[model samples]
Target: MTATLQPVLSADAMVRDAAGRAFDDLAADWFRSEATFPDDAARVRKRQALLNAVAALGFADALASPDAREAWVDAASILRAQARSAAPIDMALLLATGDRLASIAGDPSLYECAADAGLPGNAQAVLALALGRCLQICAALEAALDLSLQYVQDRRQFGRPLARFQAIQHSLAIAAEELAASTALTDLALACMVREGCASARLPGLLDAAALVLGHAIDVVYDASHQAHGAIGFTREYPLHRHSLNLLRWRDDLQRLRGGELRCAERLGDAALQAQGVWSAVTALMQPGDRHD
Candidate 1:
């Protein structure tokens, strides 16, 4: 498919306005302590603050939107802004509220059906969570890559900056490629979801592909960036560790919570076999009339 996404285009512009500016401003003012990284307790407090800020921006109502496509777009854009800013908040909780919030927070008794409920039976809500988390991972990887590049340029070894070395350049290039691939997969998945609605049979497989791609990206980015910065990058004193640690945690949490046994690859393989080929599967998935059962 084409890289041009209409929702992404409009959402990008929309996120850059007041809502986006407010998020950025709050991030700067609230999490700008470079002297020390916040502890888990502190992070929890900050997350609540962020939840409030997001609600004030009217993003909390997105999951309730009657228009499934619009809800997904709004949630994705809001999460994108948060992740790109490297804010210390739980990206998963951004789309959760009320009973959904309770369920996502581990209080399953409050809403056992939440995972399978909402506009169009919460299929879009689940997609929004995955989509938001994917966007956040992409942002974290991008931040790590940027920090590594800057570190390599400034920190010298062997009579020159590390970035001058071809080996370092090669590593960073690989990191960049991984980031790009993960991002493209996410956009493609979003396009499929928007075009077919969250009820399409192909939605699960597309999101699985995105999750798998992002999972690989976390490893590649973590390795490349840490190798570039050496021991200094892992230290809490630097901002690199924040993105790196979050990437690791989020990857694991997403897999464990949503993927279970890493069956995404297997499921996708079965899908291709069922469709007779990868090309046929993809083409059929994008067809206009396959939105529902």
Candidate 2:
């Protein structure tokens, strides 16, 4: 049977602008003081409120629509902005997996339903979480990069700006490259997920792609960010630790979810072997209506 093509959904300038403004305002009003919370309880309360606000903004409903790819993009942007501001909320799992689980709770044995339908729902959820985390990490890295650049330019050693040192510049450059690569991988994964007439068979491969990108990103980006910031990066007073630590924690958390990275790699290898060739396997994973460049 020939698969019907569905138009890819994208947020226009107005939608993007509105989402950006709303999330910025919400983050500023509620999460700006997250780092100053006296205890875990207070932090949890604030995080709940932030999640409520996100739901009210229609994020929960957006994930239910197959064509709501733009909603996913907006969700990622919101998470990224929140992380860059050091919001104490767990944006990655909350929006990515939480919303989907809530939506599917009415069905008892949803896993069986997913299997029968060839949906791979759990993998899709993980893929979404990974993509959201990637965007968040990218934003956090950008903020760290900005801070490091400012510090190196201002702090002088031997009557010269630290930014003039080749070593410092090289480290920052490497961090920048990792950040860019992570962002690009995120974009590619999203494209594959939203391809016109996306197929269930492609879901596992897409999930694997997201997992690999995020796994690599967390390590390289985290190290480079810290190296760029030097000793100050580790201090609690410095904002760099906020992003760096969260990225580290989230990577580990994701690794624990649903048999994690090792399982994802195994599934990818199995699919490739079943297809009989690596290149053919990848090509077969692409959506029927996807454009070739």
Candidate 3:
């Protein structure tokens, strides 16, 4: 046999694949159902179990990966998969070390670690945590959309499926558009982080824009999904409520984080004005070497 060379996967690809497999195992073993716990104690037990399972899956090793960018990519993948399950787990805190520094009284998801100037690399770690949370939100929105799409396609009214209606299509289309825009903004922010490190001066602006877009997306996705499923969506038996509730909680946490949503909007507006336009401002924020005047 002639000597044959097998292609070697890059480190990033290997990391992503390992994270995906770990999540798949978790979903199969732990998140097989969307059933609710009987009480707070039960819920706490399940949460603790989830943390143990995640730890067993070697996520900590992935988090400590040498390549910072690959480590984030792996974390994002794991968080996204966990969100899609609609399981009540604080994967963010488990995967994102900086989230442990959350100074918020009630909301652990809202981070304040980035502001601690005395801590080395705290800014980058906080930024990574925020980005990972964004991925989770996006994944939850995607699950809701997927459920709504399936419901409409199967539901019949009069003589045809609800999906045949233009109004339903329009609503779903708007939801998808919002989701896509939010995801794209987050991806752009992640790209900026990969190119310029999460501590880059340009990162905060991109993150602000991503957060602004994601806030709007959560609203649109929630309305459209519930509207599509009608009363059933609100029922505890239906799984849609799980993702919806998660989205709403995350939205509130983001709004309350740091200086709040209004401050983020104000900062973005100020940056736009400084750059003379919104498009130019966002474009400059994505550039690794751009020295904005």
Candidate 4:
């Protein structure tokens, strides 16, 4: 039997802005340590704080009670900052959020449904929203390659702006091309999911598109930044390097491990002409043993 979704109370006020405050405080404090984050205790603590804030809102359990609605909305807001700050960390948030919802749904007495279906249902919806938001950022970051090149123009290497050199120019050009591909592919994937309400089976294809684009964008950003800045870019004091650390981790997280591989497999499929054709093929590929069903 299909597990039903419980009615969540309609939430009017959005708590995303408030969560921004939490993220800012935590992020600032972590940066103050002048330490590499993710590995830094301050950064971990900051992420945990955000996780606690969302848990307080009972976002994962939103389907259980109308009372959880406010938390759900608030969790979404906190998620906004997390996505802006770190994408891999978003995976951590998803695991936490998905777990709670699954627990509630599994409790027949509490939610009146099987946990099996509800858990994945909640995960799917949340991930869809996340993928869309992340794609927007992904596109913007790729665009930065062009802007970086412009800034480097008239900039001198030994009294000459590095842009004057053929090698540097060619590197920048390649970075731009790479970014262009990332931007176009992500835009297309997000459109498929957001507008079409693309089927669950098609999620892997969409995420694979995201992974490929995101992974490539990281290399583009890292390479272009160094090519533009030289030795200064590698120093701890440099802002570019700080952000690049997160980019490196995010690329690895999206593509590394068995889980990541499976996620990409969900998307890798035969090429087709239209978006609909692609999704149709992916969906069919994902069908269960009752293939005809």
Pick the lDDT winner.
Answer: 3
> In model 2, where do residues sit more than 4 Å from their true spots?
1-17, 24-61, 88-126, 196-200, 286-293
Q: Sort the candidates on TM-score, descending order.
A: 3, 1, 2, 4
Greater lDDT among 1 and 3 belongs to: 3
lDDT (Cα, tens digit) per residue for candidate 1, span 154-239 = 99898999999999999999999999998787776666555566555666776777778889989999999999999998665777
When summed lDDT is taken over every stretch of 10 residues in candidate 3, the lowest stretch is 101-110
* True-vs-predicted CA distance for residue 194, candidate 1, Å: 3.5
Candidate 1 differs from the real structure by a C-alpha RMSD in angstroms, to one decimal, of 8.4
> Sorted on lDDT, highest at the top, how do the candidates line up?
3, 1, 2, 4
On TM-score, the stronger of 3 and 4 is 3
Give Cα distance to truth, residue 91, candidate 4, Å: 21
Against the true structure, candidate 1 reaches a TM-score of 0.70
lDDT of 1 at 102: 33
For candidate 3, lDDT tens digit of each residue in 185-204? Answer: 77766566555555568777
> Where is the poorest 10-residue window by lDDT in model 4?
105-114
lDDT values for all models: 0.63, 0.58, 0.65, 0.48
lDDT by residue (188-272, candidate 2, tens digit) is 5656545531233454466566566667766776776677667887775777766776665555434443257888788878878
Looking at candidate 2, the ten consecutive residues that score lowest on lDDT are 102-111
What candidate 3 gets wrong by more than 4 Å, as runs, is 1-66, 88-121, 290-293
